[model samples]
Target: MKKETGRPTQLITRKFAKELHSNFMKYRASIIAKYIKKEDANAVWFSVEELENYIHYIKSKGEKTGYDVNGIRIYFGVYPEQRKYAEKAGLMTVFLQATGKKIRKAAKEGEVQTLALVMDNGDGDISSIEPMNYGSIGRPPSLLY
Candidate 1:
């Protein structure tokens, strides 16, 4: 009788297991990146109240640092749960409520030029820009989107 060639059932060593685990992690990261990009491209504008709730949600979900960029206080690196909540809330409502006062002030001052709405993945990567303007042209950039 001839011996049959079959798959070996053996335990993987620690080094190999670690490498495999690392590869899986990288793959997961890539998937997350793609999802973030898609979400960013489809990001909506949120209100001040919504934004505040989102910030709170982010804090609850394990966000540690908040970034202040060009007068825009951005809360990033929120946990998956927080991000999901924000997404469910949508951009239009959340951001609009969050920055309602600012938007109103800009309108009153006639300094609102454009509003750029953006969303990011938890991994330090951003996706898109949704721009909204108050007037037709030549307005100063006093808006933070």
Candidate 2:
């Protein structure tokens, strides 16, 4: 079979999308209720358009910085109460990618870091690509709610 070089739309699935959204709502409801005002309605998920645009931007920016551009780490975030946006304390997404050599070194050194990266074993098996889900905090731009 010929390897299709373009992005694979065949991989998309509505079933999982709905399931993940439902799961997020189920698990995240309390946190949203506590952190965001009732009117704020913290978002359960982000639109694909927003996510795709951000991914494209990451790829472009990563190439400019001369990195192999292996991955993007999306962190969950919220605007603080003092934030002027309507999404204050609402869901936000922070996109992190391989920026510079310094970040890679920090990951390798295993030092205590809030700003840190984890490099895969140099053996080339990217086991991290396996299905797993998680998030961390950040400030808001596009609110999830």
Candidate 3:
């Protein structure tokens, strides 16, 4: 099958990952730490299964849009700064967005369709959706389409 014009998956080297992870740690401690919970001031990670299943769900839900389900938008997000949402208050995170062409093609249709794979708005908890990993960051950069 032919591919469509959209995001492309990217791969990074372990050396590069290490450098990036180091940068993240520095940046988090210097800037993001104060705004978020102490425990949350590290990394936000999603397992391979979690991501793959979400992609499957997105494709299934969109149901053969012909737009080609081969891209995604990972948006930087922040938990609302409120007492009620204290566990995630002002925390920085990323959202893995729509991969279905129906959702991606919305850009061409004058409006963009977004599907943030967060628990409040996705199916199957997406592997617990936001299981923030409190560890080092950086990995081979994967630009999935």
Candidate 4:
């Protein structure tokens, strides 16, 4: 089989594309279902600005989608510095690859982190505040400690 450099020829890439599409569909459906089941009509999952900022931030760092988990597509290579900004914007569950392997905050390798909101801090500035890890189910003290 001859391999094409620019375009994918009859190879495993086709199967992988199909798999990604299927997974995306499932994720979309789950999100819709969750929203529908919610009692509050004004309930917000994520705002447009937040999502746009997240995508922009992720792209700015040259990080790509690592994988999809629970309807959220995880992107990898988000450094500790970038993680704070992403988390402040409400992006969590970062992964190292599309295989769904997670990454931890401030980890050297194979670390996993789940970002959460700390508080409004009454400054009306989410960016002004730094994200803190009080600890969670799957997290351990970062090497910084």
Candidate 5:
């Protein structure tokens, strides 16, 4: 229970660890929701770089499981500021709607699936390029497919 530095793990039980994990998850959800809402209000398109920066900012707050590039891209829509930059950089930009209790509830209920829709604006025409499923949060039966 004691560490090399003399800290005691006994001071923190499994229950504490579990509670901490839950709290952290809640905090992460809140942060993601805040940023998403801000983006929605501004009507600003975010590139992958911007997303990464956002992730980094979150991590700086001592949050674990900070946004993984691949993981995040699975649920947000890509809207690269400069299509050429996205192509040259080999990354997709995206637009993320604010994550709300409603969406979270749907995700948990299996009534809806969170998807990352990638758009390609070629010749000034916006079109769906790809869509990726991130994960389901709700009921087991509803999450199928």
Candidate 6:
């Protein structure tokens, strides 16, 4: 008569439970990060070529933004969702740009975020150069982006 013990279990105490939860979150995040691409999880990925094509398409339809350039193009005017976001921020409009030549030129070195382009033939693509906080005109030093 001997009693046998199998595998040992971690006793989840209040303090140990907190540590266990924190460690589990870290481990889970690491596992998920290994499987997820940064762009896939956080942002939309579009190519320069795609943008160029979209620009050409819009231009063909006579839709142009004031910021169209060889590499960068921007479409003005607020869309329904964008308008909602802007309204939430108490803004009448949110000037947008793609991370192209014009956007780089407009944004102070780091103010620009990744450009998001959503294609639409009817209203043209929706392009947003985020952290939309810049001006377009000023002396040689303060032009908007």
My TM-score estimates for the predictions, one after another, are 0.18, 0.43, 0.51, 0.19, 0.19, 0.19
Clashes of each: 19, 2, 4, 6, 10, 3
List model 2 lDDT by residue over 1-145, tens digit each: 9767888775757787677667765677556655654533334344677556656765565455433445554445544555664433444444333332212535335555644554434322122232122233223321332
Consecutive 10-residue window with the lowest summed lDDT within model 5: 97-106
* Runs off by more than 4 Å, candidate 2: 1-12, 34-57, 86-91, 94-145
Model 1 C-alpha RMSD vs. true structure (Å) is 24.3
- List ranges where model 4 is wrong by over 4 Å: 1-11, 32-88, 97-145
lDDT of each: 0.34, 0.45, 0.50, 0.33, 0.34, 0.37
**Better by TM-score, candidate 5 or 1:** 5
lDDT by residue (1-145, candidate 3, tens digit) is: 8757776478787788888877766665555555543534345667787777777765665454333344466666666779985455666557665542222322334445743331122222222222322222333222211
* lDDT by residue (tens digit), candidate 6, 1-145: 9789786685556887667656744665346445642111111234566555655654433334433333333333322435544322221122434332222123335558644443332332235423222322222211112
User: Whose TM-score is greatest here?
Assistant: 3
User: How many backbone collisions does model 2 have?
Assistant: 2
List, residue by residue over 1-145, the lDDT tens digit for candidate 5.
Answer: 8546767556877787767756644664346446644221111234577666655543333222222122223233433446664322222233332111111112434446754433222222111222322222222211111
Query: Who is ahead in lDDT, 3 or 5?
Result: 3
| TM-score of model number 2 | 0.43
In candidate 5, clashing pairs total: 10
Instruction: Kindly report which residue pairs in candidate 2 clash with one another.
Output: 43-144, 43-145
Residue pairs clashing, model 6: 106-145, 135-144, 136-144
Task: Tell me which residue pairs clash in candidate 5.
Answer: 77-94, 78-93, 78-94, 79-93, 79-94, 107-138, 108-137, 108-138, 108-139, 109-138
Q: Given candidate 2, what's the lDDT at residue 104?
A: 50
Local distance difference test, candidate 6: 0.37
Local lDDT at 74 for model 2:
46
